[model samples]
Target chain A: MARITREEVERIADLARLTLSAEEAQALTHDLDTMLEYVQALDGLDTQNVEPTAHPLPVATALRPDRARPSLAPEEAVGNAPEREGSAFTVPKVIEGVES
Target chain B: MAQRLGTLSELRAALDDGRTSASDVVAQALGRARELAPAFAATRGLRADRAAEEALQADQRRTARALRSVLDGIPLLLKDNLNHRGEPTTCASRILDGYVSPYDATAVERVKAAGGVVIGRTNMDEFAMGSSTENACDQPTRNPWDPTRVPGGSSGGSAAAVAAGIVPVALGSDTGGSVRQPASFCGVVGIKPTYGRVSRYGLVAFASSLDQVGVFSRTAADAAALLQVISGHDPLDSTSLDEPVPDYAAALDGDVAGLTIGLPREYFVEQGVDPDVLERVRDAVKELERAGAKTCEVSLPHTPYAVATYYLIAMAEASSNLARYDGVRYGHRATGAHDLQSMYSRTRSEGFGAEVKRRILLGTYVLSAGYYDAYYRKAQQARTLLRGDFEAAYRSCDLILTPTAPEVAFALGERSADPLQMYLSDIFTVSANLAGIPGISVPCGFARDLPVGLQLLGPALGESLLLRVADAYQRRTDWHTKTPPEAS
Candidate 1:
């Protein structure tokens, strides 16, 4: 039985960087457990020699010329940013004790 | 009832022969879109004025005998996930509530270059996460066949728009049956090209590996025309295939004589499939056989594990892809955050809908330490087995046929509360996506007064063959000719 505990759910949520309410966390425990149990059906399949296929089609990483080309203007690139200052995106400070 | 417009080819002929102006066609389609809004809820927004201006340009080009392909002056709707410069590219999510794209998607750019006027953006599931369109941040798109039922999603709005004749063709991104399932429900033709066949440059990522931009149209020929226009290699997308794209429209000779089609026994006997849907699909096979196509039974032993494998991989990728919406750059940002971490968590919590959050959480769980090998890795290996199944099956057959979905469109909110039930709706369509093959859903027949779809899948880079079989079936059946009463 693939049972996910409430603590485990909270830990996963933290790792995912999602803020969940107490109710959401509790409900997610049940949902996750249900889904996990269902997918466990795959556990019975014999895949001893099978290679993991990460991509559906076989594609080698494509390389392109390194020459610089015209790109989006800074103003246009950050046009959708919720907070911006002079073509730079403004965000909450990452380091504590840092001066703005 | 509003009178429906003709197919893309018919419209093109009208424009070329001076029977109707591009402005007239665009105006008429916009008028119908507005009138059908309450019943179908297909369009999230419209660009009627801008479309009219583009239509005038197209007419001017026609007058100068300089038409740009058959798509010149044709109006089409874009699934909202596709970026169009200066237009809102919300993937029907609150996170992207007011986000406007700064450039056009590669597909959108190609359409514009061909003189196709962008009419509007259609609604979809929040971040293309759900089977039904109910997850949209805006309103749910109703099936044109029955307003009380849902138009299957996350391309429901695009399917509904095409099914209702609001536009003859529309672009939709298919990740695990998003395009085909909705097209089946709405009684329109939808095609998902081989993975990497269509460039995903500006498409909002759902599950990057599984996502492929597809097309919806009233006929296979029309779908072919549109696919030909938007397909081909794009340097901007590293994953886009570098193979030469054939003339898909010309490949539609409506002849499938002596072609071998394999019917996977597992799909027909699956537990949850509606009997009527299976019967309709069987009848379609019989029709194809009578038209000189040969059919044989094949076994894809690992088919039963496709749903589980698809979800695990899709969610895992979605979790990683969606981490970009961290309230730092574009999209919705939360207020009252004291730290960067809080800003991200709170903003995502406030922006995402239920289904999206659930997938993200599940994805995180599978990829987390200790459980990674048990779930994520196992699913990946199983995906390889599933792909092997298709590869082996294709060794004897040119194409495979199955039902596009388990059943016809269901009522809104019917399966909304049960996530697993909703997930099962894509059972018949996801395998093609998993195997990276070309697949198309063509309206086959009606069941219980609703349309049913017959899906045809082909090998990788086999779009021409898939379209040929579907076009031939369409020529023999009148199901694609029937219009929903709401728009007739």
Candidate 2:
């Protein structure tokens, strides 16, 4: 069975918030399919009883006392923003007619 | 400087005995960065002003007999992905245009706390993707041994910088053999410590689960000197291990008596690997046996599934991690956006390189609703089995030995066209990351006049033992001391 199609690749690009050119979409369709086929080696493994491992080490939530500490100044936080007005980042209009 | 700067220890000795001043050493390192830029293209930019100021402080502290540590006054390079306060952490990608770090990465902060001088930011594969540095926005870093060949990457610049003698030590992040493969190609020592062994606060997540900051140096001891300063728990990084930091330098007793080094039967097979590279690794094992270490053959049945599993997990994590680069808060923004959604898509599409996009797309596909169970979940279960392989192997041996890469560095653009071929170059090194164990790549010998890396792996928090074995083998052989003729 075909693992993915060019249309699916374009859908994935959309899902990833990336707009791909037609050439890029076609190329990635082939590349992603090849990689998906290669990864089929895992189909032979018996992982039915095996538990999944998201992290290599056991992790516990790290909690500290609630207290305000020194943090990045507002200007510093927005210093690299493409467009900022008074320590706030300006983005494209989010709502239907409201300015953002 | 009166004496030639070779290793961190040698430079420290020179500084202690008044052979060279800290300012002069920093000047020499900065000068080398500029002189070698055209040939290697290793660093993004040199921090000449900051280095001079830090060197002066180090000298004043030395005069007061308040020398901080082994890293004090030592000039070193940081991979461009890592934040260095005021410096731009580009990750060698155009997506991060006009962005500068507001705070220091935990590793960088620790190094600065010890008075270590930051010399420059080294180039790397964009977002620590790709086995070769060719995926970067900047010119690829070439191997110092043969300028026409590639320095294996995404940490290729750090490896090349150390190999070419631009600096004694450099920092790089290893998600899937980024540091070690490049180190092997460049004939330097690269070490990826156990997961959570080093803090990842400002390292810029490539794969949050597998990413760990690593070191590249000419010798294990020099790596140890820098690793010591950078390792330890940081409250900033929740995943950072809270365990006590070991005395890495003191562990280098050059003694490997009674240590059992396991050689994975799968990795030593006749096919896939270059014959000469295998021979060098076998000879390296024999040298270790001569120095009082025992060898055994072990099986990691899940070895064949590592590459697939590694990519699945890495890409899934990368997709999520890279979603932050959508141009709203920082980094490159599209010029003309009619709406918010197009702005994000256009910014990312324009900013990311080919490889980065390919990975993001694959990652998105794997994690999508329909394919999640078949791909991502299955790969995770296989990851558990893979870790079990290491756990079982470690019961019989204290350390595992293998070739770092199947072959030496290939010519530039040789494997760039084939992503699978380039991904396979990391075959021998990625397993350690998947298992979240410590592994080191040390120069064993040469093949076709190119460096071959002999890898040594240990279980979780086994850095001390791994370093001991590597330090012992390096002591017995001159491979670690051999410098590129062009570099010398």
Candidate 3:
């Protein structure tokens, strides 16, 4: 079985920045164990020499003509914005961070 | 009024024959929508006034070229994550409450140009994450079958709308079974075309590679009617396939005789799959076999890792895609923040729900620098193994079969207590996505009154064959025609 340890759970929580309730966290531990235990089924299969296929269709360098059609007015695009400033939809600033 | 009949093709044929005007159809559809919305929670922000006005012009000489496609005069509910001009595309997330779209998605425009009346936006998961509509930060969309139970999600509203007879067809996005799972749960025909078959231009991305825009309808024929209008190349979405879209409705009755159908032995393993659901799917396969399709017991040995692989990849893409949701350009921002970092932190923290945050965290860790090779890379390799398994299975069979989900709809909060359990709901549906192929869910039967979906998964570019078999199976059974409790 692929053992999912408490440290891994804490690490996943830290990386995801989740403030889990004691109950939710404990519940997640058991569920994750179940998930990993079940997923252990993959480890039994032989994939020794299989070259990974990423893109379904082969990559092509052929390019298409760049075209610009009518654009939705700024007001229309930002109309779904829960918060806005002028033509822009305002959101929290993002940058470098080791968020939990 | 009879001109604007139940099926989309019938409605379009009526328009072609000078029976009723598009305006009349839109008005009637709007009236019905108003009548049904309260009971089913199918739509938000109905655009009857706008749809009726635009549809009136369909008869004018100006829109002649646009009305030539299969969907002329048909109206559809676009799940809210898909942006349409002048429509609120909220994705059922409180973060975008009352938001409006400045532009129409390539898919939306294609349907509209084919003379489909842009009707209204349907409710969905906050960002297309959960299986039940209960995840919507807004209101949960009720199942038409049993209002107390859920219409599967994250496209719950789209399925509910069509299931309740409010609309003949609607668009939904599938990432780990959002479209097909719900179609199965709602007992409707749901088709997730090949991953690149439709453009994702105006769709708010959930999981980039796996997110596919699909259609839901009362029957495979109706779904084909909608697909014929929506599937095409779009310069807007780089990932959209440039190939020609087949006339799905024209090709509806393609021969299924002698086609090989693979029954994946692994999919039947008890991870939580209900026995009744399994039996119904087996019964559906027997029907297909009776119709001349050969059934073979096959194995997708790596099927067990699908859920884990799907979550890691989907969450990784989600974290990256949602990075653009910072306050300045799109989405919501917190009320106050002392500095830039705090502003981003608090806004994101407050904006996303617990599940979404949990996914983002899991995603970030899997893709983290040190752990990349072990978690992310290993999963990608497993994806390769999974695809190889499918390839080997397909060599023996033309199409594969399985139950769309483990069981029918769980009560709203039944699995919400554990996110892993919630994610497990998608186990069966995620494999096709990993391989970038097409899969669809057709109503198998009801277990305790809730519908079970019989999933038909096909090789890449295998939709035409898949639909033909599904249509054939549906023709022999009345399952697809059974309306939910709300409709009755």
Minimal lDDT window, size 10, model 1 chain A:
A1-10
CAPRI verdict on model 3? acceptable
DockQ for the candidates, in order: 0.88, 0.91, 0.31
Model 3 chain A TM-score equals 0.68
Model 1: CA > 4 A from native? none
Judged by DockQ cut-offs, the docking class of candidate 1 is high
How far in Å is the alpha carbon of B428 misplaced in model 1?
A: 0.6
lDDT of 1 by residue, B419-445 (tens): 988999999988888899989999999
Model 1 agreement with the true structure over A23-66: per-residue lDDT tens digits: 99888888888898889899899989889999999998899889
Instruction: Give the residue spans of candidate 3 off by over 4 A.
Output: A1-53, A61-100, B1-5, B13-21, B59-66, B269-271
Query: Mind listing the fnat for each candidate?
Result: 0.87, 0.91, 0.37
Candidate 3 lands at a TM-score of: 0.88
Q: Each model's C-alpha lDDT?
A: 0.92, 0.92, 0.78
Best by DockQ: 2
Residue-pair clash count for candidate 2 = 0
TM-score attained by model 1: 0.99
> What is the RMSD, in Å, between candidate 1 and the native fold over all Cα?
1.1
Name the lDDT value of residue A81 in candidate 1: 95
